[model samples]
Target: MSVSTLVPAAWWARLGQARRRTFLGYLFLSPWLVGLLAFTLFPILAVFGLGFMEYGIFGRPTWVGLENYRDILTNDRLFLTTLGNTLYFVALSVPLSTVIGFLLAVALNTRLIGQTLFRTAFYVPSIVPQVAAVLLFVWLFHPQIGLINFALDLLGLEGPNWLGRPQWAKPAIVIMGLWGVGGGMIIYLAGLQSIPQHLYEAAEIDGATEMRRFLMITIPLMTPTLFYNLIIGIIGSFQVFVTAYVATQGGPLNSTLFYVLYLYRYGFEEFRLGYASALAWILFLLVLALTVVVFRSSSSWVYYESGGER
Candidate 1:
């Protein structure tokens, strides 16, 4: 008998239902496991290694030790500029999106006519292709005859060149970000619906007004969903690229030069692959740190149905 044949029959036979199920489940998940290893895990490690080198993509990488990181930390004016811009965007966008989304969810939760139509209208912009949405916004924000500017014109007010001016450009991007707030609104709506109706009824019987019920019950219960959207919004805000890439190209005195856009320019445009890799690693670390901090803080605010720890 072959050595392979002699080894495993008894072991196979000894496997119980739970082990078999686990094995089968892993078999079903093998494709994703392979992808994670090959595409994500391997590339991440490669980029981390590249962060310590001077690679220009066309030639062999030369060891740079910590120079790239030191430059980024101390000397790279554009890096600091982009980092500040990204932080500003994240700080502005995440809270605004969360509050606006929650309010929309609350408004839609009431029994109203054309509710389905309203929800659909709100959600459609989010599903629009990113390139298409950016292009549309470019036209809509056009200084001369765009719809938004035209509306302003009717009010005897002039619209600033949205993509051209420094002061207005980042805010324009944030306003564009709000157009997709419906995605978070839907999540909030689900959380609102899942809330036990009896709690509200009981509160009403105890003479709780609508405002009091919303404050006392709805806000506390919805904290988990709010926390979720807040983290996602912050992460997504940091990675803001498409609008800056397509609409502004990080222009108007680099007013909209976001972190990712700067990284992309280094990697692709300037061909400073090593510096770009370092930038990418920095971004990953920043996001991971922020996520960890948020997770830690969540114990203070987030609610879980299973317990009352918070």
Candidate 2:
């Protein structure tokens, strides 16, 4: 046999040894892989397949080509409205939340008395179960009887009928989103911790003002976490449903009609599975494209400690 044949055998032997050493790695990860395949990948493919059909739960799906997409694109009024509403929410909430989270992280990362407690307090809302949080916000935003209005009264400011008025309902959701930005805050906190103390010391030695230090050192180093939160927060905000559904029921004349809320209405309420599937696919495509753009742009700004000497 040629020497190449012996080389192949040697490589195969190495591969076998590696696999033997890491045998339990696959077994340990089997449950997650199975879940990804069965629940995630399978359902994604199924939804894509369904998007091209008119599917009744009990009947065979009738192939409809691009009819569902055309319907939404050409004639669906609520589709466009909900899409705009979602985009508006993302535009307003994502940046504000990201900035607020980063600022809070910067503040919380400092060495101060009861700092851990402050961090926990900020993070508390994030761990609240979704349904419970939504329901709690329902009472908190009640037009006249809510704590929000109560606080407004204390401040001599009128709290608009939050859930009652369409114009105000979306703003209410945005405010609610800010309250639960703890997830982003925690991520920023982690990123802040990862930032080398020497950078701040260097900035201090250079007589950089606090604001200048933050603008120059803190933000640049925190770009990765900021990018991560921006991407995730935007995606989550785009498909916002729980707040609209629980708080407004997509009411106040569909002012709070979110894209995912509308999708859920079609899928569950109207049983337009195919159309909902199409919406899902469209949302997936939009998020995917946006994430790609963000990642591509990140290289221009994301700092990497300049080879550990930043």
Candidate 3:
């Protein structure tokens, strides 16, 4: 009674409500903050610091100034080759995923029999373990006895040697990557569902054709989702490693040598930790620049229902 009554009523109320909520909020967020500090933020800062030094895992890091960046930009032919390959992959895969995912989402949104079954069937491939998926695709794309070539044979056509040929290797990887388009399709489906149905109904009342309704109403409204997926797809495409690592090993003359795989080779395999850190920083900057450009351009197209601007 003495201690509680000594506190002002207004201050007690503030402590009971606002301070309690603030404490609870921080308490709930503590784990994530701890993880960010211990793992993410520390590693990122360490990598950035290491980029300026000559460090191997076994020894202490020595300061080397901008030599790593200079060598990567000017002297490293493989770096340029990998960067180009990464850009090529991003250019093809991102758009293909976006278009295919949008189409699949649109199809799923229709009133069709067994729609739920179809959605499940499409999404299941995305959840398959990466190693298993790569192995399955290797068998499927096998030049001799695979199902894909068998189908081509049945249709009186020759199947290209996918992983064995330089020109076809990256495309084979792209095809493998597309198997996970179902994940993007699910996101697009969510966006499609969130769109107001009344807009479509109004368009129907205005005598708009199906195609017109889709073009004028659906596409514009889905731009935010499209933008989000595009950025993610771009980043994923640049970091492509698994398929090439497991199936192709960036082989058939390094046709599928993606940026992250190249970085991994230097960091872990070749033991050039400092150079690898530089590569990582370069990749980060490239992604950041691309993201910034996309965000800047979003004002032209992307629309939000609430704020009316991206």
Candidate 4:
């Protein structure tokens, strides 16, 4: 074959291969692109647009300028309360869940009889339907005839009415929040598996006890996973609406009025789309700012297996 003929054939083959690879990549990405436009990107832009107008269901939107933002910042009393409540939930629940999940992961990571069974049991609560789980918790934490109260009574202690007091509302939510530590535990477990076994053996050979080995070797190495769970827990807790909506209805004198729950109330009940849109943007900014701070601080602590660049 002539050199020109050979070169043309090779070039055509390479071009066809490249086209096939590109087609497959787009095929895999199309669903995500569609979802972004339909569910996330479009809605977010629509909300942003809504924030600048006076939107009522029955009334045409009039350009209201920055009135919604002004009201959220300077006027709304429930806005402040719900924001405070949500912040409080994030502060308490995130740390509580992280610590609990970490401890559980460490404990279960040990080789023991029925280890798989124990892991499965711990994880089952995580997959339970939200409504069913909350209902179960309601029954379990009932002031009377509840398993919690019953157990306390058996221990010769009086369990305070968990759902009845404003002082106890946040604590109750925090406690219930710990029930799904299974998800964080699973993440930690994967991180634990990634950690080389030689690290523990080396620490032990140096006369380090189990606790010391874990603190020095495991915990430090697990910082990336720890940071991940911490951030997710904080974000999820900040948007806490389901439990408060179902359990308290933002009740006990509005002690459990979460920010997102209040956002829902404004948007759906009051038809204050413009105000809700502003609140959503405020939340997005707050989360973005906090996440930036977390990423900034991660350089001081989070240890990644990728040699810390990640």
Going through the candidates in the order shown, the clash numbers are 0, 0, 0, 0
Top lDDT hit: 1
Off by over 4 Å in 1: 1-22, 308-310
Q: What is the C-alpha RMSD of each candidate to the true structure, in Å?
A: 3.3, 5.5, 3.8, 4.9
* Top candidate by TM-score: 1
What order do candidates take by lDDT, descending? Answer: 1, 3, 2, 4
Per-residue lDDT tens digits for candidate 3, residues 1-310, read 4434655667656686677678667867999999999999998999898899998878889999999999999999999889988998888899998999899999999998999999998999999999899999999999999898899999999999989998898888899989989999999999999989999999999999999999999999999999999888877787889888999888888898999999999999999899999999999999999999998999889988778733
Q: Estimate each model's TM-score.
A: 0.93, 0.88, 0.92, 0.90
Please write out the lDDT profile of model 1 over residues 58-93, one tens digit for every residue: 889999999899999999989989999999999999
73 Cα displacement, candidate 2 (Å): 0.4
- Measured on C-alpha atoms, candidate 4 has an lDDT of 0.86
After the best TM-score superposition of candidate 1, give how far the Cα of residue 185 lies from its true spot, in angstroms: 0.9
